[model samples]
Target chain A: MDLSTLSLGQYTFVQNAFSFGLAVMAAATLFLWFSRSHVAPAYRMAITISGLVTAIAAYHYLQIMLSWEAAFSAVGGTLEVTGYPFNQAYRYVDWLLTVPLLLVELILVMRLSKSETVSKSVTLGGAAALMIVLGYPGEVSEDAGTRFTFWVLSMIPFIYIVYQLVVGLKGSISKQPENVRGLINGAATLVVVSWLFYPLVYLFPLIGLTGGAAVTAVEVGYTIADIVAKAVFGILILTIAMRKSEAEGNS
Target chain B: MDLSTLSLGQYTFVQNAFSFGLAVMAAATLFLWFSRSHVAPAYRMAITISGLVTAIAAYHYLQIMLSWEAAFSAVGGTLEVTGYPFNQAYRYVDWLLTVPLLLVELILVMRLSKSETVSKSVTLGGAAALMIVLGYPGEVSEDAGTRFTFWVLSMIPFIYIVYQLVVGLKGSISKQPENVRGLINGAATLVVVSWLFYPLVYLFPLIGLTGGAAVTAVEVGYTIADIVAKAVFGILILTIAMRKSEAEGNS
Candidate 1:
């Protein structure tokens, strides 16, 4: 499992894959942004946000791959020097960047469809501000304590998203939009599942589950799940955006 | 790791939780069906499908909990077992039931907006059918050969999903909705990440990654992911359904 032992060719391959993925993601974001004006205004915002979030995630992953190589080089081909901070930084950056975007996308979709009662523009503006406040600092440090602090700060927005989803689901259900309720429920499920990992990561050390491959596996598993959540929610938001535009065109 | 020594109270707690979850799911289904006429026809169908799928998953989890108790009792109050066929059955059932619904939900959303091209529907339909076929026999046995077959078959729908998503993403980028493209990309990412476990689970025997807590953890992790996926996608479908209805109402 000593990743540092990887040959130069293998290291280059990993680095290339990471960079290429990020590049494609950036291209996708720009493409989406340019096309936004052709669609409904609300959906335009949703796609824009989705694109930005995807770019952020791609950047974070790229950083992880680069750091992996750097840490390996630092150890001169040894895996024992503890690049754990790099790993932690990757996870924190991921959560801070993607989760709030997901929330905003949902709200924008609801608002575009006129299903949301609140002034969505104002709410979304507030959420964006909160995301910057929470996420920016999270990406600044790989220190365990600082990362943990940012994670707690990040939870404030996470909780707000959950509340919005619950209320949205209820409102949609009241209007007999059972399908929307179902979608919100699904997105909320991921939020809850992703959050479940946080306490485990932070609290497991207290219960002595904080070492070895088990801990590593937990971290990896959570990271993968978070990625899946982003991907799934991102698509859901995109679908909503498209539907909103089509409706506008028809009208 | 022998689960057989569990006191009556622990078993009862699991049993009750399973039952309560199932009952709530059942009620949700009935309510969904009953509310159909009050909603738009397209969304009505989506809601029905989503509700049914969720109910099925809840039932499978309940069955797993009950079977775990049965296995414990059969083995003279010990949790250790030679194999966990019942657990495997539940897992396959959960996948077989949900993956198709997810595909169908996506198609349904497009259909609601009357934006789906015929070829896209055909492709999605074919994938949905394959998921059911692969998933059905997966629940039959937990033998290594059977498990391998199940995993291979399951991959068909997953791969198809990835393909459809790629196509959809490209299409959205070129001419259609930006949000739709975003959603497809997101779903494609999840499909890839979730299926990463298939090879791991199937190949672990060859690599000697099997046994005790490791095996249990993998199985449980997959199950949780499955549940989370179903819940999230189910909600997404609901969102699309609601948005479509709102559009119709406004029109």
Candidate 2:
């Protein structure tokens, strides 16, 4: 987004979101990492992956926040673009690495057949990677046609991923322990809904929003999604692990 | 991940990742071999496997770095992809040898019953070798369908190995002296998590990252995973061996 100018409120709103996103990620990383012992050994890898996702997200949010502060000069009453350019690659890079892993952790926790887990993880992970990588060009493009074209390209994989998450994983989630069955569904739905939210935020600029408002909507919208997809969703995954761990007779 | 368009920054990122990876492996090899005397005689083989894993990884990193330099020309102000096809086979070859040893080291250090050790080692190591062998065809394939097919083939062994590491090893880890159990879990998680990361990075090219970006992601991503899975993981194993030795009353 081309943020030529911003009011103090808009600037701070994004800043707050970034800070909050960073905090959520940091907290989630520690929570998941240290709690590894609480779960049975079989489920540790899944929870560990959830910790990894947040740890990487925490790093990106930190860098993105610094970039946000650098690009906008808010020291004085004037809010103007600075000589330093903001790097948007951090968000895409984070998504590229973490999105696939998110699917992986979910698949790992399900305790599916070895072949099925392998099959689902590779297919779903590859699709998630495709969706993130495809979205990057359109995200950085200034032209409407370019943005719209890439959006459609990225959506192809996005649809595939969501279908797999919902329909493909339906049977697996049902086979989970009775206690975590609802939470597992919640986790899957949370992933789909949060992922769906990302494209809408990507469309803020294409859908008539421009300038500072577009920038704010896109940034804030993404922060909310980031928190939901990584941290809140991670906590949900962790809770499922804990429940399954308890069911298996572990304290 | 074929080398093509590259900015100076992207070129350097891969170069730097290679160099750092090389340094870690080289350092790890020396550290493991020299430190081997500190562990009990029974655990020495485990530490020896650590050295072997890092030593093999180090050689590959050196070759990989050289290939990377040969594949790209950045002597002048202009940066360009050059004639040399960066030999990625070095990685597969390295993994083919060391991956089996990775599991062998873990199993040996656990000090399992000789019969159980032989059985688990043969099974896990064979699976590891099969995983790497199955993965190479897909790695070299240009078609997405071919890559996906081989990825599925490889995941079959990957899932079996993970099961052995998690469920199969759970009872064994619990039987270990308290000090090194956490370290063992860390090592296992590191292997699984890093191994999982490699597949997703392999998908980068197939997904949408083309030309320079795909090459950059694959190169840097693999380098990072290599350091973690081989060198860093080797050290973790070494530490566990030392702790176990001490717990056995060896200074």
Candidate 3:
């Protein structure tokens, strides 16, 4: 947990995580900003909410980067940068806010009945926040048992989210225009697959990987997963939304 | 480069890369196999060829993993696992064979005129192979200047491939069945974007990151990019092919 003791490799790994996170944040923001006008009125709320998720994430990542830089500077030339443990709290905060909205946007883009949208988003989104809240304890837990327990607890909601997307929403997704049915399935599956990484990351210590190896694996894994889940998933959602909007116009 | 000399961190990095590559290979192969029956007759060749690309890469990655394990055992248990430099030649070998085929599959799936497909595949695929071949010397070069020189040289072909995909193929792509045009464009753009990582990976050593840091960066970067380029691109290609074939059938 001490930033002062990190090896150069670990330092680079964390820095790269921040860089990757920030890049995704910026790219997603720019994409949503530029493309929002092109989305349909029915889909515009989803697009705007998508932009909000990235914008919020971008801000939080900037704070994390600053924390990283501060820690790096305090250590001067030494790879074992001393001082504050870069507060990763910013990431949890970011996810707590954005994760639920991710599901909300998906629901919004689907154009289900208002009551259906509200009920699904509230239930799924609340579970998403709880997933983050539960997983955070495991992420910070030093004991293997505690981490494993938290991981299992988090997966309860994670599994539910996947089930809701895969089974519960199957009908709604099928009702989408044929052109976008494949993409709708792809987006849902992408979320389920990518979100599975968090629990895997939490179990790294149990697998006997500690120090820089564990650190690098967890950070890099999460970064890759986030890119797929947030940035790539967002793009898929946009594509589906655009296609459906166009289809409705033609019809 | 010495597997025996690798720190545990380096060992883990290489092992993770191998795992990732093999996983991608298996996933892509399984996807193509399962979907082959469903894809249209005209598009079957592309799906089959896509599976071949991953199958070939998987076999090569298995070899790379064996070489790594051999080196690790020879080094014994020391963190400073010194001596044997794990051969990365397998990667270049894999790319040389598969990169060209990637382009060919793309061309095939598009179902362009036979003459156009042949010419574009030969030119683009040949250039893709050349890019990897040209870049390999620089990858192993101890001298940064040699590395940068070769990296830039490789970019000549890389740029041409991009140009061919983006500009030269524009007309042909535009003629694709209307429903799948966006998907086709997405696939082509994915290729151009993902391939850009190669030159960037080449520049890592030049930026004063050497040894394990540079190795990990380059390997991890390439793995991520390759997944995007090959596996993800294959999926996009399949989706496009499926949609187009379905549209044709309905018409």
Candidate 4:
């Protein structure tokens, strides 16, 4: 059956799913906001970070809807672009948002261990830089000029972040609470999982693993990894929030 | 672009990815085992459940390798049959493993709150039954007749588990320790996130979302969600394990 000939009911169903996803995001955002004031300062920051991500995801979905219109117009009389700028704006905004979130989370975890202030700032800064390099340009762009330049520039910080995490984990291994240690280790595993596919994705094309569907499969795999990372990271932050409050009450 | 024409190197790379995945599963199993002796008896059971899941995943990977000869032969044969039996077996085993792990984690959290036994067992048993109903026949046949019958049967248990969780949450909402409560809530959310797409996946075909690729996309989406659930649940289990150990030490 031709997808293009989708019945009205089918179209409505897909549209409704997308709409429901948007509503869920909005609700999550509000929930984060409401809980923000009650949490410790560090957790409040994490909630703020989560709120930003939810907002970006909502915007991304809206932009996807606009891209549909752009595609339709591109096929007809005159080409019209409805959401390119908004889409492109969020591309970098998403990276900026995630980078700080990752860095802040790492720092907060370290601080919970009562690590040296100087070392924590340096480590957090390094992680932030790494996130910028790896996550920049987003993963969807096909423009060679943009993709290649950003890809090259992004590796510097990515390597640095990996180095810092390894060093930090080694140094702080003895000091961390068991739960925090487990979370850090799990998050590190997820980061490695995400990065392991990067070369296979971007570099494989240059080495001839570039068939159309194969490339599509790689992208889908990366997206799946990203989603897993986000979900795990969200749980980690929630744990931090709850644990911090427990500690406070006992004190 | 025919996949069959791929040289030895490409095939080896793909095989290596699967092997790497298997290795990760092995590591996860080891982690689960180590966790078992560190938590309370109730929480230890949860960790054991996770270990059981890891074992199933390991077995699934081994099955894939064992079925490789048939899989490769089928690729070259006139019949379009892939070694989908092995694939389906892995998928169902993974789901069954996940459902129990999720329920056990929730039960451990609830146990921390009120020490209620009968209600927790009923809820967990209901969840296990639902998982078995959905998972068993879903793995056995791809034939429409079997698929339709199993899908309907699966829904009965799925709905029941959801109802159980909702009621359980309401009952324990005010009494739970903040940390344990957060963990339970997060676990419930993860379960919802993992299963949210089920209806989309099963009902879509009835609504005319056919074709191999479309079906594969939905399957992959579910697989990714499963990974996310495992990662988040792993963190939650670790949190409880650590707290249980700490409480034991204090006593």
Q: RMSD of each candidate? A: 19.3, 12.8, 15.7, 18.0
* Candidate ordering by lDDT (highest first): 2, 3, 1, 4
Give the C-alpha miss distance for residue B224 in model 4, angstroms.
1.7
State in Å the error of residue A169, model 4.
11
Worst 10 residues of 2 chain B by lDDT: B72-81
Among the candidates, what TM-score does chain A have in each?
A: 0.63, 0.96, 0.91, 0.63
Question: Candidate 1 residues B1-251, lDDT tens each?
Answer: 23443443343334333433443344345334433544577566667886777778767766775676455432232234334433545656666566666666555555523555345556776786576577556435446577568768877776776676666545543442444445544544555566566546655654455544444555555554554455555555555455556656831
- Candidate 4 regions exceeding 4 Å error are A1-150, A153-251, B1-21, B37-42, B64-70, B73-86, B112-115, B134-146, B208-212, B244-251
Considering the two chains of model 4, state its CAPRI-style docking category. incorrect
For A15-118, candidate 3 gives per-residue lDDT tens digits of 54665476456546655655665577889888888878877877886688678756754223235454667776777888899899999988998899989989
Worst 10 residues of 1 chain B by lDDT: B73-82
**Deviation in Å, model 1, residue B98 alpha carbon:** 3.7
For all candidates, state DockQ relative to the true structure.
0.01, 0.05, 0.03, 0.01
What lDDT tens digits, residue by residue, belong to model 4 across residues A68-173? 3332223444333222121223223344434544555545544544346446655666566565545444343555566666666776666766676666566665
**Could you give candidate 3's per-residue lDDT for residues B50-162 as a string of tens digits?**
77677666766665676566455434655643233355666676687678878988899889886888688879988998998898788767787898899889989988898
CA lDDT scores, all candidates in order: 0.54, 0.82, 0.76, 0.53
Best by DockQ: 2
Best by TM-score: 2
